[model samples]
Target: MASRALRAVVAVSTLLAAFTPASAQEAVVNVYTFRQPDLIKPALDAFTTETGIRTEVLFVDKGLEDRIAAEGENSPADVIVTVDIARLSAAKAKGVTQALEDETVNSNIPASYRDPENHWFGLTKRARVFYAYNARVPEKVMSYAALSDPRWKGRLCSRSGQHEHNLALFSAAILHWGEQRTEEWLRGIKANLSAAPSGMERDQVKAIAEGRCDLAIGNADQVGFMQTNARSPEQQEWAKAIHIVFPLFENGATHVNIAGAALARYAPHRDNAVKLIQFLSSPRGQQIMAEQNFEYPVEPRLKASTVVQSFGPLTADALLMDEIENTRQLASEIVGRIGYDNGPER
Candidate 1:
């Protein structure tokens, strides 16, 4: 249907469009991210607006360490942004991340939120919570040990036990209760699953809304996503069906996880990478993440978004990062040994 002249220039137009003049000379920082792209874009865009440094992002759902290692020294990954402390530890262990000892970055974040050797820095904090169908479930607060009660034998729903989120929680449990007790606790949880470990945190929320389960374990941000999901109106219904219950450990503190950033070891654009990270740790950067992603900022002066704050006060346990990272492999092994993924017996 196109004119002959227009048809003749289409391929040429496409070729020319592929190579922008700025691509050849502008400062650019490449990022490998495990967190959703939209979640970090506001802060990255703010960074570019402030410093004129273009950010290039690649999303990898899994195996980021192996991919970065495969690329070796030629990897264009100047920065890595991801969730879960275990993955960050693994990247450093794999020698893909370099220590970042920036004074500006250090001043912006707390020592508890950044690595001791400075390989990664926590950007945002989110709680691991329970979504319970309010109409059917009355009791609000829960102790992790209560998960095994026979009353919940067919009411519990979760993502895979080996998932980084769940694994991190299990690792924390190992440190809190010891491996023998943690394994027994995991076995009890497995015995109560409504379905086989399946889908994402959002899917577990959906299951609760459908009345297929009464209690679902998931991260707090999924509730924010569902409530704000204009693209999927049905998800708003899911959000309305339940109330978030912050599960407590025996010591009365809740489990929290972070989304963090690191510098790649072989970064070609080292200065630009450091600049991006520094910007990401600034008050403006922290604000952007808090407002857009429904997460708690790493900066103590700033508070979580209003929606996040409404989930109830988060009493974070004094979890040691090194201890949690060290115990994660054992957590995965326990999941395997007990066949936690097999779900409850019919």
Candidate 2:
């Protein structure tokens, strides 16, 4: 009887421990993200609910690369997410992230949307579209290269050249047109600025509505957000003033950038981190991203959000996403030399 009691006690204690919250089950993954919180919260919620892996986010408005570089290998970050190829390539080049060996990631993500060396994968592909003042500019000005026609001088508004979004577009031009043609394009676009380079992208759209300029360069998601917002009358006005124009290269493909992720070099939860990466890149998570955030999924064949699809089918730029590693530095030099910040009248 005593022996039976002892066995039962041992079994009960073991069962209780197995069911209890232990360190393993309570593990947290640190994520460093450049995306606005609202954009990624739903996906984050689903990830935690499904896997029981807790998440902690550190949001950076600027200097993310410097922050991550400072942390070095001791960084608590398990994953890093951001938009544009320049920043992602910067992280990979700085050794802040490590190449992953997950077969699921390789299989689920298209080769075009991922690093050739497997260091990062693009989550969504967004076109660098133009936002034109519909009432002021004619539909005939559909091509991006048409912005340089001199007829629109002092009728354009843009974010500063230092902004990553602008830099990525310029980099794409450099890849497609070479330095000389790209320089000429930049010089001509500079000849058309309506105002000095100033303000955020949303502000650029607002400027268009207010008659500060007849056209601007902006991302598609921002336009969707503005048009759909319930409270802001100005957003509706901005939406009304603008129509999107997708630019095509000589080969007839549009330039695209992405929101993407990489595993940190010192990720403590290595296996779980890889699992989460795979999950996000998979068809299921990509769909969730599209539905929740208006982001186009990197997985081919999946329809994007209704708003994304409304922009119509896109033939994205065929350049490797990682080529920013080579293009960014040169782009910076070229942008300054061409005086993008000094305005068109310069």
* TM-scores, one per candidate: 0.89, 0.88
Top TM-score prediction, candidate number: 1
lDDT of each: 0.86, 0.79
Off by over 4 Å in 1: 1-26
Which digits, one per residue and each the tens of the lDDT, describe model 1 over residues 1-346? 4787797688755633442223334598888898889888989999999999988887888899888898787677889998879888889999999999899999998887889999999888778888999888887798888888888988999999989899888888888899999999988888999889999999998999999999988998889989999999999999999999989998998887778899999887889999999999888888788778787787767888888888887887678666677888999999999999999878
Error of 2 at 85 (Å): 1.0
| Residue-level lDDT for 146 in candidate 1 | 83
> By lDDT, who's the top model here?
1
For model 2, give the RMSD to the true fold.
9.5
Worst 10 residues of 1 by lDDT: 15-24
Candidate 2 has a TM-score of 0.88
Clashes of 1: 0
**What local lDDT does model 1 show for residue 239?**
94
Model 2, CA-based lDDT: 0.79
